[model samples]
Target: MEENGLLNDWTNEHPLFDNGQGDKLSRKSIAAIVKKYAVKARCVNPAIIPEGISPHSMRHSKAMMLQDTGINLVYIRDFLGHSSVTTTEIYARIGTRQKLEAIEKTALSPEPGSLPIWQRNRGLLEMLENPRDVVFNYYL
Candidate 1:
């Protein structure tokens, strides 16, 4: 850092990361370091990592990875620092693996002839509250 005209006396600077014995660097400096290494890595192996990879993009990938692991949407929302879950939902794409895992985890559907009690009744007075589960009886 000294050779690059950067400060080496971190004792006074409040940095997010420090070597404990070295000068502290601001967030901008940290990001610049990452950007520098990314450019170097890109030149070394152009196909290993994307050319445009950045700290923010790494955060996005982490959020998507959490969503792909079948984590609760609400948890993912908080993890990604979104003000609302709707925003986080934008990153939660249900890939084929998740879909298959969800299907496998669900309670096996009752046998064809052995429908649940509500299905046979079609529209019992008590079932009127929320019949969305009865898909077969609904036109939609």
Candidate 2:
């Protein structure tokens, strides 16, 4: 398609891929193309393409790939034209090993001799001990 100049003239007025008549390809046309290629790929390797693969599945796979490459969810949301980053978070799902690795990577290690702030503050400790007796001011 690139060799045929279909990919060269992309603009706001022109779509990336189009039908022969200079119009955008319909959803059915795009699905048919994907299915055709998937069938051909399956002939070469039956395990490569799964059954019931659709354009939406391809889109999800691309989103997951982008997420796996460390791309931000906000960026992925914009790339996928999603209205909300929360919607894009579906692709941010990680496996158990990935979750553990991420947690370990970000795990906090306190300084050797530094005490926690609550332990160091006598007034805060008193406040914790007797909440009603202590008058907490917003400025403090």
Candidate 3:
């Protein structure tokens, strides 16, 4: 996997993450850090953000982006560690959002209408309707 660049394991020196440390990062602290950095960067250049963007938004955006790339829902569900597929489905809001967008884009989508055999030839229904024609066609 590493050779193919599919997956990489780098838990050894994660700054925010520690081994055997029960202190997980609190959401408030992360939000404050994100806000501080975002504010500082925007002060230098306001184009760094639009407005009201937070770390949680960025994380959700990343998850949605991953789901939009055709990754399996089951895999995403497992990655998020949901107790049930239904629970994992909450994280799949992005996928559903994309699906809704697609439906809107293809609101006037075309259909096959009918199969080739249905249009070109008689089937059991036609045969039952006209037994003589069916027998004559079969003989011919």
RMSD, each candidate, Å?
A: 12.5, 14.7, 18.0
How would you encode candidate 1's per-residue C-alpha lDDT over 20-46 as one tens digit per residue? 555577667667887898888878887
Q: Which stretches of candidate 3 lie over 4 Å from their true place?
A: 1-24, 94-101, 104-140
In candidate 2, list every pair of residues with a backbone clash.
none
Instruction: Give the candidate number with the greatest lDDT.
Output: 2
lDDT of each: 0.65, 0.74, 0.61
Rank order (by lDDT, best first): 2, 1, 3
Winner by lDDT between candidate 3 and candidate 1: 1
- How well does candidate 2 score on lDDT at residue 30? 96
Higher TM-score: candidate 1 or 3?
A: 3
By TM-score rank, best first, the candidates go 2, 3, 1
TM-score of each: 0.49, 0.60, 0.49
Candidate 2 residue lDDT tens string, 11-64: 556876789887999999999999999999999999999998999988987887
